[model samples]
Target: MNLHLHGDAIPEGLSRRARSFVASHGVRADATPLEPYRERWLALGVPGEVIDRAVAYQERWGGLVLPPAPVYECGPRYLYADVPEPSHGGGWWFVGGEPRASVAFSFMIGPNGEFGLWGDTWAPLHASVEGWVESLALTHHASQWAKQVTRLHGDEVEGLSLDDFEPVEEVQGIVDTWWRGSDSLVALHNGEAECFSGRVRRVALVYSGLDKWGLHGQ
Candidate 1:
């Protein structure tokens, strides 16, 4: 299957606000020049080569910067290159920008077939995508996990940390193996979405807090 992927390599700690904003407002593909992302990239003093490469990558695949929206929380945003998917529980929204991987092209998949995430720098975000996807899958695999989480905490939402959980490699392996059979996956977020047409699925949102996620789409 053919796929196209588009995302931002945003700096840490600055993604939540962006994500919240979009979730509150909505996702727009035709939104002109993405100033927030561009400015952030420029501030990071990212190498021209990397910028050129990323821009070229987007151009080749029709990737676009996420449109500004009301703040949902704070952090990087991952707007799909296509429209949001309606199958999965609500839709998938991004709290952090796509994760980066050292490898140019690494394929990661989630069991639900919701969407894929990737990154440019692997070492740091190496398992980021796998972590996010696997974490989400954990709830699906063992509904007990979610039930326990909810029942244990009740509506109080106390002590829920994304960092506290670990990704199950075995489950990720199954998802990855399954993804190989398909050509591409459709990604959705904040009432908007995009399609990734490539072999690389490496983007991820660093889950610093549980509130970073919401049931808006669900």
Candidate 2:
């Protein structure tokens, strides 16, 4: 399937907020500038399919200096897809990154062409770059719409009430995951917070108020 359609999968309002967030805190580049990098990857023997998805993402949603929502309370992060290089995995290629500096992980295209993060290990964050963007957008949406927003940290994240919530598969998180409920969406993150912190710093944002399009769209 074409994974690039994530931009269309999320609710329009959420996407708008995501764009606004990026505009305020990030730098977006015209995808056309990626043509040279695409040619370079091809010459480097990167698989055609891998290059396809990565190129599409860079062209569309790629950016730089993007920090996660303040609610996340994680380290500084950004989306910078400069050039492609072979990853430790045979067919994957280093494409970008989510976090920065010491705890940072490079973004890559997985064997099956999935958008992923490669740190000390590899973890697929989403099916596509736009999926990651959707997760970011939903963060703002859920936080604003929920009747009550709850922030859980460390082991407290384990006690979160996720009994009736459903996984948000489109976002396709490995360390990070999103859940939807009758009136809420829970965003659980283990990236820089839990996994890399060397401590149980897991975090979860529970957004509870989807009485309208939030529930209906999905």
* Candidate 2 wrong stretches, greater than 4 Å: 1-27, 30-32, 37-49, 64-67, 70-80, 97-102, 193-200, 213-218
Q: Write the per-residue lDDT of candidate 2 for residues 18-115, one digit (tens) a residue.
A: 66555544554333456666667778787677767566656555544455654333423655455556656566565655554454555565665555
Q: What does the lDDT read for residue 192 in candidate 1?
A: 10
Per-residue error at 4 for model 2, in Å?
20
Tens-digit lDDT string for candidate 1 (102-206): 323222222233233333311112223333333333223233112222222112222323333433232233222111101111111211111233222223222
User: How many pairs of residues collide in model 1?
Assistant: 46
Give lDDT: candidate 1, residue 134: 31
Root-mean-square deviation (CA) per prediction: 17.4, 6.1
User: How do all models score by TM-score?
Assistant: 0.24, 0.67
Weakest ten-residue segment in model 2 by summed lDDT = 1-10
